[model samples]
Target: MAWNEPGGNNNDPWKNRGGRDQGPPDLDEVFKNILNKFGKFGGGKGGSSDGKGFGLGISLVVGLLVIVWFISGFYTIREAERGVVLRFGEFSHFVEPGLRWKPTFIDSVLPVDVQTVRSLPSSGSMLTEDENVVRVEMEVQYRILEPYKYSFSVTSPETSLSQAFDSAIRYVVGHSKMDDVLTSGREVARQNVREELQAILEPYDMGISIVDMNFKDARPPEEVKAAFDDAIAAQEDEQRFINEAEAYSREIEPRARGQVNRMAEEAQAYKEQSILKAQGEIARFEELLPQYQAAPKVTRSRIYLETLESVYANTSKILVDTKGSGNMLYLPLDKILERQNTSNAPSTNRRTLEGLRNQDPAAENGPQDTGIRSDRLRSGRN
Candidate 1:
């Protein structure tokens, strides 16, 4: 069952043809046998042909390795990216976005995204100008403008930019009041931080352009939040009140102007009416003057009589003549006016006039000649 048993044929599994005990095969002889097989390909018996065949095999291996290295050097850049070439671990040049190649070991390419916007946010509780602490959060958006500077100008551009942002934000916060940082002054503080950050990064040339800076949030500490909210509310109310007042002023001003215009128009109309009335009066007097010049006595008598008739029509008192005897009748005007005002009846006034006309004058006064001028009045009329 077992080979090399004592009573067995003493057979070796490795085929020991010498029938002698051997430890193991020698590595030198095995390699020589392999070389002999390869030497047969040269189809020669001398050592010179074997050496040439070995050299050819070594050259083929080297060529394959060189081709692999050359192919590995070729890379592609994306549409939004640029490649920064480094030669022997130093900055060489920049490459545009496309398929490109370089010496495998002699040059390297570092692709940097140039078209993407990067954001950096910085937030912390900072001391304000009034010695109050306020938590401020801000974000800076930037883009790589120069790939070379972004890659090699500093050890780490992003770290340096972050530090610059911190420094600028702190400086701005330190110079601003707490109320302003928390409220109406956030925009001003944001602008100042952006300007100061740009200034700080100017010397380093980090190849970053600040597209925008936003004041994300600003607030007081938790302990004083309620109080600040109240203050802000009061400020808002004050603004609302001011706006309302302005709106009311705008609404009322037009109405007041309209009223003033209407009053002015009314006054103008009254003035025009008075001027027209005066002109008409002047025209009437001018016409009357000519008539008076034509016949002075007749016009004078007619004017006197017209004046008397107008006066008598307005008065309640009347003068009556007794045709049979030289007697004058006196009518009580006060009693008649009192009766007329109390009754306001035309019949009462007529009855009073008729009773006075039919009264017996002889019984009341016996022949009282009251300077009778009836004949002169009649003569003037004629």
Candidate 2:
């Protein structure tokens, strides 16, 4: 029954509807009053209901914010990179290549590319050992080997790396000769730079590994380039001249030595021939002297006859004894002598006069005649 029914007493019959001993209001009424209080649109009471509604709405917004906060803590890492987690600005752990999450607002993550090669160029002017200034250009290739160290050990790794490169270049170049730096020193310079840079980075814990370094160009300053080129050309010309002189020496020295050796050999042969001929002539004279002592007269006659025959073989004149024949035989002795002195002397001197007999021979051959015979024998020997 409703409380505002017309049949109801002015005292409120509904008050007694359940019973005077009822402990509290009806359950349905209690629920109805609670719904009404919540459903109010305006006023302090309505505002209180609105405050409850606003509290509920605030709770729902707070729940969504919490969900988003949880999601924001999660992160992802790619295959080529490594993640370093820092808890309160200090390194905590490392994560690799996948989805990962860290405590929100309490931890931070830094991703470093460990596999990718990074390049930095270094260039500057430096003094060499020869006290020459030159410009050098080079590139360094590096990669991160320790991600945690790269992220946390140094505040600025790239800056430190640049400084290391500068120091290495200066140190290497300062000690090198200008010519070497411009030419064959490129390889040496790269090696030195790599070593020095590695040392510097290791001490600072930069976590960088140098893969390779390359020298791009090294040259003298623009003001001195022409002079350097001229010097190089001069060096080349000097080497060429030296090579040509050496070649000429090689070609001529052997020929000159051979000619000298040939002359020496010819002189030696002539001396040996002269000595052998003198020895042979001496031996023949020794043998003939013994034979002549055994038969003096016979040997003398034979030698005289042989000498006369050899002397007159080519002569047309007849030598007749003037004492035996009063008529003198006119002989061309001058013509025979002239012919004997010419080109046919050797062959003409070989004939002998065997059958000529002297009608009026001179008494014994005297010392003058013997001297004449000796002269003829000596001439034939010669």
Clashing pairs in 1: none
Q: What lDDT does each candidate get? A: 0.80, 0.76
lDDT (tens digit, per residue) of candidate 1 on 1-382: 6786788675676675577556577999887766665565545365333776666655666899999999998899999999999999999988998999999989989999999999999999999999999998999999999988898899989899999999999999999999888878888999999999999999998888999999999989999999999999998899999999999999999999999999999999999999999999899879878988997665665555444445544666555555545565566765566655654544454554446435533212211311234443344334
TM-score of 2: 0.50
lDDT of 1: 0.80
TM per model? Answer: 0.61, 0.50
Give the Å shift of residue 93 in candidate 2: 1.1
Instruction: Name the lDDT value of residue 220 in candidate 1.
Output: 91
Q: Give the residue spans of candidate 2 off by over 4 A.
A: 1-45, 50-55, 232-382
